[model samples]
Target: MTRELDLVVVGSLNVDLTAAVRRHPQPGETVSATALSTSAGGKGANQAVAAARLGARTALVGRVGADAHGEDLLTALRADGVETAHTLRDESESTGTALISVASSGENSIIVSAAANARLSPDDIARARPLLASARVVSVVLEVPVETVCAAARAALESGARLALNLSPVVDLPAEVLAAADPLIVNEHEAREILQRNGSQLPDGEVAHAEALRAIGARSAVVTFGARGSAVAEPGRAERVPGVPTEAVDTTGAGDAFAAAVAWRLSRGDSLPEAARWATRVGARSVQHPGAQPSYPTLQQVLDEPGLPV
Candidate 1:
């Protein structure tokens, strides 16, 4: 049976090993952790779950190891309402894992081991072309190989679906890929990298980041500035969309949530500004919880929150 999808995410999936510590340790120094946990995470998996919980018909395309972690990760994704038929199992490598340490201030440091995630190839994407063709929007992150991402993007484009790219871990994208994406999501640091690589001056303020993004060929851009909020820009207009007020517990997966919400809203035919507002609220909600996928809110939670100006 084939199900129509509102959004399809082509990327990585991993088990997250998290420890809450007093502070990040300096080089050659060790810090004691106050709490510890393990959960499912990965930019792609996080976003796919976020979208699915928010009532989007979401499908995930990636690879997982034939290990215990992989089994648990797939179960969690299914529980979150994400379609996992396209997720491949690799016996050659273990499931990917992320080692994360969160400080009391909500800041975090992370190291990722892309085991099975790195094994996702263009052929895998090609096999999922039918699902990609049925989606209203297709989202991709940089965690997967650039070639595979490009293949997915091209497939989405050919299918007349909107292509959304999260320029995470901040890498320079080829001009062709950038042109194919409808809206590119990035943070302040990523904006700086894009501007620097293009030999363009940095935007003076948060709003300027949008213009900088447009100058680089993005049809539209959203630059998130954490507590300060986010900026949304198209060719001629740009504005700061304020974030919802919330006490952050852990900042992990906040950006992925924001990106997912934006794509979901846009898939529903909302204006860019309206979608940015939804994304901002979703991001704020994610920070109030601890783990990545576990912290993400369902659509009802967002709709029921009185703080959001629906």
Candidate 2:
């Protein structure tokens, strides 16, 4: 029998091409760069690897191309103990790629060439139903087709698994699936864009935004304010958790790290507040390193967090 997974992530998979620059370029301006590098990425894959490395029995259900990039991606996930049995290889499209520029301050700007990631359809979601249904938590990012995301969400809901949705590179979410997300994860910018596009009554502060996020559709919501920390909302109350103080080297995958930590803690039976606290510690640690997957800390490392928030 296939072992049940702690978290099953269904979305995109990609290879990342990155460069370190002094700062982000302004409109119509160019800047010198240093240290070009490549790695396995894509929000879905990043979150899966992060959770797996942290000892979650994690699986990835996404698509890549039938090429070298796809092979490398599989190797990376397997190295981190992420189950890739459900990850598919598409003969029609090339593997996805992301062009990333990281400034010295750890902030990054990314441009994605979606390729095979864009081709992950609802049909693909159906193929992974058993894996999705057996997971304790099913998480997804807005990298693949939105319909595919909805299919995964519906499957998880039907199976009574907790659903965590990250609306990154934000897009309009279907009402049914959006409401099914137990904790709708969005960074501050993504949150604002989603609310505004959906014509949600925009709230003023982080706490209020989190509350508003819950009001919209999510059973619970978390609005992350980078450096400042994050605010979470459940039924009875809402509160803010301060960020772990750190000097960051690169902010790539920080939000993915946060989402994975939340899912991992939830799978371990931690409450929202408790989960957010641990997530903050993990996110802060990610910014101290350079890539997405490489920056993630092990479960033991998180346990040894010196300044983890209470």
Residue lDDT tens for model 1, 1-310: 2337899999999999999998999999999999999999999999999999999999999999999999999999899889999998998999999999999999899999999999899999999999999899999999988889889988988888999999887776778888876788998988898888888989698888887888878888889999878998886678999877889999999999999999999899987788999999999989999989989999899888777867
Per-residue alpha-carbon lDDT of model 2 for 1-310, expressed as tens digits?
Answer: 3338899998789899999999999999999998899999999999999999889999999889999999999999999999999899899999999999999988999999999999898888888889888899999999898888888899898888999999887888788888988899999888888888888867888899999888888899988998899999989979998987889999999999999999998988899988998899999988889999889999788778797654
Span of 10 residues, lowest total lDDT, candidate 1: 1-10
Q: Please identify model 2 stretches exceeding 4 Å from their true place.
A: 1-3
Tell me the lDDT of candidate 1: 0.91
- Candidate 2: count of backbone clashes, pairs at least 3 residues apart or interchain: 0
